[model samples]
Target: MAGARVTTGSRLGVRIREVPVPADLDAPDAWLLRGQVDTVNEVEIALRGNRDMCRNPHETLGSMREQRYTTKIRLVAVDEDRPGDAADPARVLGHAALHLPRQDNTHTGEVDLGVRPAARRRGIGSALHDAALEVARVHGRTMLTTTTQQTSEPTDGPLALAPSTGSGRLHRDDPGVRFALTRGWSLEQVSRYSVLDVPLPADVLAAHRAAAQAVAGPDVRVVLWESRCPDEWVDQFALLQTRMSTDVPHGGIARHADVWDAARVRTIEQQFLDQGLGYLVAAAEHVPTRTLVAFTALAATPVTDEFVFQNDTLVMREHRGRRLGMLVKTANLQRLAAERPAVQRVGTWNAEENAHMLAINVALGFRPAGGTGEWQRDL
Candidate 1:
């Protein structure tokens, strides 16, 4: 592998191949690896080309898994000829990627590319893109999509993101965005980040609690679940996963079967528990029927800023105006506040046009911090 990568940065003997599981050594001077791994060695290096933690290598990796496809492409560009002796041996020169999945109706998730300052606009970015598009077409899928931070700074510079840990900041002029635009990808969906500058104020929280209490009634019970909850709920969690698409505005829709499964639910539940966080779910119990309507859930993991990650707040068509969204969010927020009181601020991203969820967030006092436009190219 070292012999293959020995080259000068001015010219790369680039090679792109779809070698699965065990990667191939003779594949290329420049390379990409795909699939789930217990380790990422350093994807963060490619994501944090900005000052703010706008690019999430962790979340991006999760997206690939959540979509039940390996939308993950790991690129390695090194001076193959110079590998044996340099101040920093095997110094990666360029990194760009996209995840491709057949189950996603041939959908692909393109990511921002990061390049070392010594190499830019020299066709490396174009080559990465060409590789992504080829995958989309070969898989019999029609669309390829990705997101980038909307910024006014220069986007073709020498910034980099640390790998794995979702903490490094990306520069506004990071080369990833520049490569995305230059390659002809256009806006698809816009994802915005909301930051709670202050806490979810006292009085407003009181009023929200009252609202949930006022309407939750005796039949609908809101509950918080930690690892201690009965494992039998995995079936219910699996069902809830199918309802996730009720409100999100992402471009390519994931198949219900791909997102819902008892085993997958158990894995996610365990992951939350292992991380010392749980989720809030609202269920309506009808004593007469002996069944529960699993309506919504809000889950979060404690990161540097205490992310109040919210997902899947679904209401049956018959229950829409009943404020179930507010009920679920309020329950989760109160639970987190009471339990993990150290958690100060909450943040979430909503489609610019998802008024229902937006209304709920605004009512809960989540304010907009930034927005990202989802771009797609039809193959």
Candidate 2:
């Protein structure tokens, strides 16, 4: 639904337009859309210099289309084609996307913006952001959220194994940080990124698994599922999903609680399928009640075999005494090894203050990889 009208910078011939994906999205448009990620990745590489990164626009767009969360995407393009431009004439210079979640976090909208390295400081980012903020306002969102990364700081201890920013590399300051602060965004939360190298030493994996197994005891059972939850466990699984909003530590950030039902759970599961990404889930069950007491998930995209994303590990409070968290996590690690053997490592994020979860991750050999600042601004 791209119209002839432009949103900004007519004098510079930079046009900002919506890239709508109708139900019947065609190959040509999809290819064009995916190129934007490539441009963004190029910029990321220049900034990050290859610290394990992967982005699949196919999954991003498809997931957005299927999820209950609505999204508005705006792309800035130059009318004149440039040499080596993947998208000619309407060469995508940058883009911004606003995500509005339906279940909860209704008062908040997440915003992500990226500008090509060569296109920075040309007002494309600001223009796209302006348009995105307008869209958020139209949807009645009161707060805008975004994340920015700083180069990993030097550290000793287990985190020392993580990659460094190279000598003389600036650590604290970044253009994104300045951009957000200048626009009135306030830092809300800091989450540390970590990665676990795959194929942990036989002794290490065995020791951790044995220790967790001993704590889990005979009354607890582990369950494994791919992509979809079974009908019988759907309700319990949904409850656990809802609990994550309150259970997980969010630091000082104002996180909205979520309400999840079986149908909504299935909708999210289906959205992963629509994105063509692989999903692996592991849950622990209480033997007597046959109830799912804890769960964790890992997602892998076809774009890269080098890394997989570890997401959402949650254990119910009543089930906390046992090592259910460790059990389910180790169980999923075993699954990830068998199913996605090509994956070389797994990356995860944890709030800086979540000592319990961080301890579990450290026990599993996940070392600090980087850090990101979660910023928020009142609309």
Please give each candidate's TM-score: 0.66, 0.87
Q: In candidate 1, what are the lDDT values of residues 157-215, reduced to their tens digit?
A: 35532212222223434455555557776544555566563356667777896786567
lDDT of each: 0.51, 0.74
Q: Write the per-residue lDDT of candidate 2 for residues 1-379, one digit (tens) a residue.
A: 2533343444444666666564444555664466566666776687667635656676667765774655545454544435575545237777776678766888887887888887777677777777778778888888888877765744444322221222111133467767887888876667788989996766777678778879988888889999989999999999999999888876555677887899888888888888887789999888888889899999887677777889899988777867788888888888787777888889898877667888899988898877777778888
In TM-score terms, candidate 1 sits at 0.66
Q: How displaced is residue 198 in candidate 2, in Å?
A: 0.5
RMSD (CA, Å), candidate 2 to true, equals 5.1
Worst 10 residues of 2 by lDDT: 161-170
Candidate 2 stretches greater than 4 Å from native: 1-12, 22-32, 50-52, 72-90, 154-172
All-Cα superposition RMSD per candidate: 8.2, 5.1
Best by lDDT: 2
Error of 2 at 239 (Å): 1.1
Q: Local error of candidate 2 at 102, Å?
A: 2.2
How many steric clashes does model 2 contain?
0
